[model samples]
Target: MPEALAILQKYWQHDTFRSLQKEIIDSVLSGHDTFALMPTGGGKSICFQVPALMNEGICLVVSPLVALMKDQVANLQNRGIKGIALTGGIKQDEIIDLLDNCQYGNYKFLYVSPERLQSDWILDRIKNLSINLITIDEAHCVSQWGHDFRPAYLKISELKKHFPKIPFLALTATATPRVKEDIITELGMHNPVQFEKSFARKNIAYMVFEVEDKLFKIEQILKKNPQPSIIYVRNRKSCLEISSQLQTLGFKATFYHGGLTSREKDKNMQLWMEEKAQVIVATNAFGMGIDKPNVKTVIHIQLPENIENYYQEAGRSGRNGEKAFAVLLTSPSDSIQAESQFINVLPDKAFLMSMYNKLCNYLQIAYGEGINEEFTFNLNHFCHKYGFPTLKTYNAIQFLDGQGIITFLKEFSEKITLQFLIPSKEVIRYTSLNPNDEEIILTILRTYPGIYEIQAAFNLPLIAKKSHHSEAEILAVLHKLNEKGIIDYHSKNNDAVLIFNEIREDERTINKVSKHLIRQNELKKEQLQSVLNYVAEKNTCKSKMILNYFGEKATTNCGICSYCITQAKPKKDFSTLSNKIMALLQNEDLSSREIQNKTKNTADDVIFVLQQLLEDNFLIIQNNNKYTLKT
Candidate 1:
């Protein structure tokens, strides 16, 4: 503990640990398998990072989120600690080199994707490393019952057979009792020390507004709250549209989604993080790896698919432990749309196999030939070419990915690659002949090494700055170089990466995986229903509802959420107000406020009774907006 604290102070500049962080770190340092159930922004990374600093060997971290892994690796490097993240879109030799560094470079941390565990070459290299600990981030993905289940995570248990003595620490921000048990069993944890922090974020005020105009409600909330906010929508088009609308409303806003290019994603996210953009209207892809501590509000324009997703996204607010608001603006149409988008249209077994075949065909993979091959997948193009519905096709692809038959990733930042076809000397000679392109060639050489040996990723802006050329000019030079056979270039970014784990198969082989899809659909329906129930529930505190859903017992109401606030407000005796309103209408027509003043009732009570009377047809409002009793 003393050593861990010293390292933390040195690296993080913190004097003490957050809730349960010290305990979890101590458990790992004591060489015991540990499972930590922390809410979002609970500092789960610190639990393993501190212990890894105390240990003698590298800590192998298996994660499902590429952005998070990269962010953490960058953070560790910033702290002058030796760490590396081996993600997708890199050459095999690059991974080998990185693993070699871990083996002999005395690196303290190694972040790896779960899918990479299936490669025998990777496993062989990992077995040779001096691994003292294994940390699994997003451990909930190991269970089929998890909202973001990934079958690649199941292969992590195989490591237990190889590194039996090394302790395993599994961490997730969201998990239920079932997922918890499944994680423990599937990971082959032995007498694991379980640390579950309270899922309740008392600092957050949960509010659900059933409003007809979601945009107007969002506007009202933004106007009331301070800046540094996130507005989550369901689709990419809405992300852009809402952001544009917010800009028109005079708020500095940006948009983000899975479909955006890497450059756009980075720029918009950086703008929001640096406080240059006060609000970011985005899809669910916006929250991961983002640690803006002062986010005051997280408004959901549409219902999330499940409670887990909703809770995670909503929990992104108030992370700084300050008071914040999580407002859900819903319309009557939103419920039906959310259900159809998430649950009712889930592809069945037949559709699953058919989609699988179509995907294989789209990639043009012959039977038993395309194992471990990855392709840049465009879902819309595939759907258009094959006459498949976009929603069902997406769900079907998700199911196949969960079955380990393939790997689908939406985040790939390895665009703008260049590889030299000739030697550097030859390239220099050609650049001398074409002096106009000399600066770009030299800039590429200086910015990224190993371009001659392999395709190297480069930033266009950095290269342009160094070369004193515009991005278009740099691209033109790169294209010229490629045409001249001096270098090979591939640009025009692809957003998705699809890897086929096995070759194309017949219906029988596909059916084996599709059978599980049925059960998966059922589980999804249950999860959707849970979300619907949470939104429809009015008697329970939103915090309590969330806590109870995660199997935590809340002893008292939060006293600040929308439900609690509504309950605490004295329930006005509307009976007297209703009688007064009816009597007043019988005598003469009056406006709502006039009726309230004449009856000596509260304004809210008067409005409630008036609305009820109007709904019941006992009173009618004229063009002048005065209520009168029906004839």
Candidate 2:
């Protein structure tokens, strides 16, 4: 147990664990099933990672997001630790090889998507491995009570049957008490030790402004802060539209969404990360695994469907312990839009069954024939071909996903592979003959080994930067190499993958999960109503309200929140202050603070009066600070 701290300091370069992180790790090390409810950025990974490094056997991490697992595995690899991830997009041979490496190659961690656990072959191989810890990331997804429940997560408990002795750790950024109990029960966790950190992010000042002009409010926020920020919108179109508007306002901005290609996503993220762009306009897809610590503001252009989602998204700010703002900009129609987006559009049981049938027909899968099969799904194409509304159809698929009839695996960025056809000696000779292509050829030869024999994953943007060329130029060179028989290139960029969990089920089978769908939709509407109530709430302290929702008792008001600051205090009346201000400013100009001293009134009252005076043409603001008679 003493060596655990050494391992953490050695690998993570940290002096000590965050609050409760060490305790959670110690509980797991002592072989207890653990459920950790750490807020986002609360060092949840360390709870499992440190213990994995200290223990003898490999730690199996089951996560829902492929990109997140890939990023973590790559980070581990960079730290000289061996790790592999198995997701839908991985090739079969690659999976075999990766599993083999985990079994014999001293791999400390193996990350797998929950859907991949359905494979009997994978289970068979996993049973043979000496597993020590089973960690489930986003464990909330397993519970029907959770906001993002996925039915495939239920299969995680199956691993317990195979390895009865292995300890399990389930973690999520946000989970209500009901969801917590469900995770514990569904995972078959026996008296698991639970650890929860306070969900309050004191550094983030939660704000909600019901504004008529969202863009104008956004502009004001950006201009006031002007630090690295993220602006979250509802859809891809808004991502682009808002980003362009910000650019038009003379701010350096970029947009990201699930619709963009992997290369484009990476390029745009890099631009923001490197400070080339001051703001990133994006959908909710943009925040996971993004570690930009200096973000000063996170503004939501629309309300999220639930408080859990909103809290997690807003928590992305102020990671470096600096004061930051999380502001939600709401229009009159935002509540209506949110209801339509999340609640009203949720397909009923009939729609779910019909969509399921249509999906089976669309994929040409006969009843009892498509179990455990994976397909390249184009939702837009499917909707257009069948005359289904895209949003409703997608939501129905999501409903189906939660019911375990199908697994909706989102898009994962694929790796590009290149294999050389020309011999090594011939490559040098060709480069000498073709000086223009010399840098790229030399770079490929230097960076990727055995390219002449087998395809190796290559990063196009990385290679371009190394060779001091553009990605387009490097791609052109690769294409030229292919044409000249110098190399064979395979770029593996593709859309989301859908896997059928059961054979095409009839109405009876689909109806079993229909109740779950109805319950889920009902819970979603309840959550939406809660958010609307929070937005419309004017008396409660903002921080206290949010903290209470997460089951924390917040006794003291967060005095800095917008609500606390705006709450009327006992003081001189506003009209009196307004008249005093006008009399004070009749002859000489004065700044706000000067006026405040002269009037001996509360600062809020003075400021309120000043604003009314300016609005009513009783005074004029000049030089950005002084106020005088309007005359």
Residue-level lDDT tens digits of model 1 in 490-592:
8755557897777777586576766567767888889888878888887899999999999999999998998898788887667877887787778789987
lDDT of 2 by residue, 1-631 (tens): 4488899889989998789998998899999999999998898888999999888889999998877998999899899999988876466788999999999999999999887887889889998898989999999998988988877799899999988889999999999888999999999999999898998888888988765457877887899898999999999999989999999999999999988877799899999999999999999888878878899999998988889989988888999999999998875588888988887778888887788888999889998799768887878788889888888898988777656567787775555898988779998999999999999889878888777878888987788889999988888988898889888888765456888878876887777787788788888888999899889897998889899887889989887677876764554557777777788887689977788789887554676677778778888777655888987
**What lDDT does candidate 1 reach at residue 525?**
87
Clash number by candidate, in order: 0, 0
392 Cα displacement, candidate 1 (Å): 1.7
Instruction: Evaluate model 1: give its TM-score.
Output: 0.83
Query: Which regions in candidate 2 have their CA more than 4 angstroms from the true location?
Result: 91-93, 409-494, 568-631
RMSD of each: 6.4, 7.5
**TM-score list, all predictions:** 0.83, 0.80
Each model's lDDT:
0.86, 0.86
Clashing pairs in 1: none
